[model samples]
Target: MPIFHKISLRPEVENYLKQSFMNEEVVSASSKQEAERRFEALLIHLAHPPSFTTVRVNTHLASVEHVRGLLLNELEKQFSGSSVPVLQHPALPDVLLIPVTGPRRNIEKQQCEVIVGAQCGNAVLRGAHVYVPGIVSASKFMKAGDVISVYSDIKGKCKKGAKEFDGTKVFLGNGVSELSRKDIFNGIPDLKGIGIRMTEPIYLSPSFDNVLPSYLFLQNLPSAVVAHVLNPQPGEKILDLCAAPGGKTTHIAALMQDQGEVIALDKILNKVEKLKQNASLLGLHSIRAFCFDATKAVKLDMIDGTEGTPPFLPESFDRILLDAPCSGMGQRPNMACTWTLKEVTSYQPLQRKLLNVAVQLLKPGGVLVYSTCTVTLAENEEQVAWALKTFPCLQLQPQEPQIGGEGMVGAGLSPEQLKQLQRFDPSVVPLQDMDTDCLGDAKREDMIWLANKDCIGFFIAKFLKCKSTEEKVSRK
Candidate 1:
């Protein structure tokens, strides 16, 4: 019943991850075999998308029920009246969930193979239409209207425009080619738009492109949960470190009804621009996104802390979010990760730097939430351990809507502290728990009814700055 094959990492990468698991403070497996099995499960789950697509309705812009009705209509139309059951998340009043129909085993594969880059294929699994830029190569004689089997070039080794490929590829269902090989490579320097019209994707997820744009934002269920945990209020100042593409940034802005300051920062220029664009598309003007490395976001001088600008003095932000740059090992439908051990382990220092800056920039008694999309202990629970040890002023605060599994055991964090944390382990749960007919299965429904409980591989640790006057006086 597996929709995706168990993907294998390069041997060196595998060994490196094994050592990562076996690292002194990480998970203490009884044997190396146990570590390998857990890691292998991670890879298998990575090659498949999650069972549900989550959309956070902008309750500020539209009522949840109204948006839900619109979205359900749009989904039914998109899926050609398939009546794909759309459910409002029982706990998250502002969110809607659509089941991803998948591992669909009955579709016949066609002979004309269209090889696309791995990223594109992952998007396809999540219900995105195939764009031309991701197409590496199609059959030489392939033309528009030709039915073709779609495959993802998992290893990133496929040569573009090649007539044939013998390299490693995985079938990603089938579609009709919208462009000829000549049309894709012709005219402009870069390709654009719908290269293939997917008729039968093994996983049937509804695409959100241009659908209810302002009413809803497509976000990972966990990411949406993070915003609610932060629980921002109107007229509060919020800082989002490493906020790119503005998923949470815009959500925060919308949650506050556009009445507060939401400053978003990212290291890359293009990504920052994207954050701005998403904000604009959502009609959110409260977000001010900047392109800057967040580790250096704080300044010593009070005068440098001008409005709508960075280089702020200590305790300027009411709430801070460090959705730190991570190894991204948790992203699903990811067939391979080529990073070496050093590369995989490199984010620890960067995350610490960002966290240090975050604590400095947050107001006294303010909340700080640290999160990552990866499942590595170094990035998740261990980071929590490190943060608590390094900053005595910080204490782990219980997350609101504690929907995810408690923190993993190996980080030396106490039971109560681990209980306060949320880690969404995609590989730990089975996909069948989310099937349509299973909706009526009350026992099963009761188990996963909470919004925070079902989500991507994510980690969130909420911290409250201790209200010790001795610490405050010492700072001044």
Candidate 2:
């Protein structure tokens, strides 16, 4: 099978990333040629999904072992009785991992083509079928149940309802059309549901469409680690800023055994609704979803706002999670990114605003975890450095179960300080060729470790509040 094309990026954005990876700290450790090679490899890895698909079990309603058994049975039924082991994580007992087989080269391309947007293409690569809303253009005479080749329009220039497209596209494999072109484009408003039933995809990742809705949450390897790094305790009030569609928020609640008050905040109403839906579907009741901007979350007055609402007084929570917004350049199977340089670098300031509030909201001796799903130095290490300097009360704490590598060197952090940070760099290891034969516990543990590093380009930094009062918020 041929390797995926490198993740397409604007020239200015690409240059900015290359400099971040090959800066003075990075160059001092290695030669310029080595740094450039690693940057190139990262771009390639970003265009492909990880070898293993990760999911977190809702331990509040089900045990990991019980959920694993059911998920394995589901996979067996879906894959025609082929054994696909659902492995439990050693450090994170509630997490499960499924191996994804991919880039199958032997499938013949069909004559009819269905074009989809870049975002839809990324979802297809990650085990989702083409949905009706994602359809960009289809064959002129395409009909339901007809075999059609699906392609991703990487340049975002494909016109909707066009008979054909001449823009740059990539073959994503073949599927049977579930709707006729006439029916799809025939003046139907707000059409929903799958448009293509994928019979053969280049990457054979499992599709969890309404499968074990309450038992499992399909998550990335690094994302699951963020909640664990927070280490929320039962009966303690916790906060999750920017927590819409709360993957981490739900995980935090589960970790606390649903006994704690988990306040989740997001700016958008629809996203907050999704967060509520996920929490309700997972049977996690401790999470309270709110549609409020996190930058304005901290209110100085205590009597003005009602309990269990946003704009709370400072030092109100035991632990806080700032899973700040980011450029999202690290997501896998991304055929292309059309963001300009300004859009790519616009998140650091917003992250700092949230971190400032996160620090104020964390109680003395409380734990706080800051994370992002991006690979920019300005958002990760540089943000960590700024937090430490700006908030003396906040000190970087060691992250347990350190599966990812240490912080990248370009950011001005000392070596020991960098060790406290976790950056899931996919380029640290090459793509794996899984061979499960004769696999013992030891071999399998080693294999899973490699998969952890190859999963996503994420970053996590844990901190502790050392001071109690605002005026006294200073570390010795």
For model 1, the superposed segments whose C-alpha errors exceed 4 Å read: 19-37, 304-306, 433-454, 467-476
Span of ten consecutive residues with least summed lDDT in model 1? 446-455
Candidate 1's TM-score: 0.93
| Candidate number with greatest TM-score | 2
lDDT tens readout by residue for model 2, 135-244? 99999999999999999999899999999998899999999998999877884787888999998988888899999999999999999999999999999999999898
Count the clashes in each prediction: 3, 0
Residue pairs whose backbone atoms clash in candidate 2: none
For candidate 1, lDDT tens digit of each residue in 262-380? 99999899999988988887888899998988888988655644666876767888999899999888777677666777888899999999999998888878999999998888898
The RMSD of every model to the true structure, in order and in angstroms, is 2.6, 2.3
lDDT of every predicted structure (CA atoms):
0.82, 0.89
The top-ranked prediction according to lDDT is 2
